[model samples]
Target: MKERIVVKIGSNVLTRKDGTLDVTRMSALVDQVAELHKEGIEVILVSSGAVASGKTELKIKDKLDTISARQLYSAVGQAKLINRYYDLFHQHRIVCGQVLATKEDFATRRHYLNQRNCMTVMLDNNVIPIVNENDTISVNELMFTDNDELSGLVAAMMGSHKLIILSNIDGIFDGDPNKSQSKVIREIDTQKDQIEEFIQSSKSTAGRGGMQTKYNIARKVAEEGIEVIIANGRKDNILIHLLKDKETLCTRFIPSTKGVSSVKKWIAHSEGFTKGEIHINEGAKDALLGEKAISLLPVGVTKVTGNFETDDIVRIIDESGKQIGIGRTSYNSQKANEIIGKNNKKAIIHYDYLYIEK
Candidate 1:
């Protein structure tokens, strides 16, 4: 099988400092991806710049509120962005397809499978799938945290070998970026490092995500056994350089040794789509994380937080409210509540449908 990778280009990388679309930069990225394609590596791109592009075209001098302006700008910008990609890819005789996804699309098994199949078909035909959020329609619950989160889900969904996140900065720094003598961390071992303390909470002017967001998504994808690289997008031939291991200053996240199943990957990345949460006791937590694979029984559930139907994705939290895992329930919340503390041999969540977080 050919190696597959998902490359995410942030808004900061796609646009100029003045918040305008940088056609030259976009062209360069396309060229790098085209070269990778010729080398037999399947590449999927998740790009963010619609709002920035739309703002430049619309030139809205006065602020028209956050949500309304975002809707207007994204609706107009998405077309321009996709058209630009079409033109750029066409120059190299490479066919590319645009995919605009919403959070609700991954809420159900059917919708999730449908989207996955579409991308699979495109890949099977040697077509590059260019993905972006359906920003015009997404709001509140229907929206993703940012494109970083979306790209992580896409990488997990497609079972990609690696996920490369491109931003303006080099990578995660040991200290503040503004501070002198702060150095970029070349590698991150999620299991050992307390990376959160080093990340800044500030968002970029051209993008919704910050350093913290990238770190989080990188860790999540790496836990699923997908290698992740966070690098500076502004550098020339950054994509090609990283792939060739050409001495680049970037943070490489080492993938876990144990590989997760496709269904479990879906459950792990679908926390946003959870209908409810199940609070499990300490014993249940230990059992699920034990050496032997175990199913979640109703007796282990101490409290049910919200209403959800059977087969709905739910968060599995410990008694202290820390989320330990996620799973699809075989019984509804009401039924599970009724059977709590009772001897029910049937598994509320089978091992196959459960994902334990590391």
Candidate 2:
């Protein structure tokens, strides 16, 4: 069956060797995606290259040090980038919508759902949605440096079956890409701990994001049961090769053993995390996990730390302060403090709002 997919193309693949927009390559990619759409697959693209494309158009040679200069470049480049995509996709008679998002959008539940709605509406109308980080107005701390991370979140939000990241390299290497002995890892499986050692960090001049960021996002999305493939974008017909022929030399991260449903996966890896915590005794912890219900009774409550409001995501800790799980709270910090250590009237956290850690 045709599946929903999120494709992330990095700046290195979108720009020429001299930091110019590679129009030929961009057109080729859009063509492949258009073909996929014809096959009935829901395609969403997370693209990066606004700054680089802008730098080339304006002929600005001086280094942009200050945040303002970077924003100015992004402001100019983002328009040019989207315009190019608009022209390219139009050739295939495919309508596409542009969505520029910042970290703040995903940080709140309301904005997250709003963004989801916009994407859904576009897709429902048979229009492809092209997403990019709002770099022009977003500060460094509040920005997503790369499209790799953005693609993962979008995949999880749209309940996409797979996330395909296109970079300059073939795939994840065992060691540094510069090292001759580094070997490309074909597949990653149930072992998250074991794979950490092989992960290496490196940055791209054309883009601020690196290999490590891709690996981190891929791992997180894979945990949500969405397969993630990090492959080369520069290769001809690369997008079609992956979906049609599966003929790419990419690092494919498989799903974990404990398969989770799409809705459950979203709840487990919700965007905003709570700063508060609630500690439970061993008996309560087991009951929450085994029974899978929410009102955490005072009988299991051992301690409460941090101030959190109702519906906030809070960590569920054990008596010794180990985090056993995470769940949305049913009450505020003051109310939790009032009920902790006693079988009071309120259940601090109800069962349906909880996600016990595995």
RMSD of each: 1.3, 3.2
lDDT of each: 0.91, 0.81
| Model 2 weakest lDDT span, ten residues long | 263-272
> CA shift at 117, candidate 1, in angstroms?
0.9
Question: How many clashes would you count in candidate 1?
Answer: 0
For candidate 1, the 10 contiguous residues with the lowest summed lDDT are 336-345
Give the per-residue lDDT of model 1 (tens digit) for 215-326.
Answer: 9999989988999999999999999999997478899999998878988888888889888988889999999889888999988989887899999999999988899889
In candidate 1, which residue pairs get closer than 3 Å at backbone N, Cα or C atoms, i.e. clash? none
| Best TM-score among the predictions, by candidate number | 1
State in Å the error of residue 141, model 2: 4.0
lDDT of 1 at 54: 94
Q: Across residues 301-320, which tens digit of lDDT does each residue of candidate 2 receive?
A: 87888988887778888877
Residue 99 in model 2: lDDT: 99
TM-score computed on alpha carbons, candidate 1: 0.97
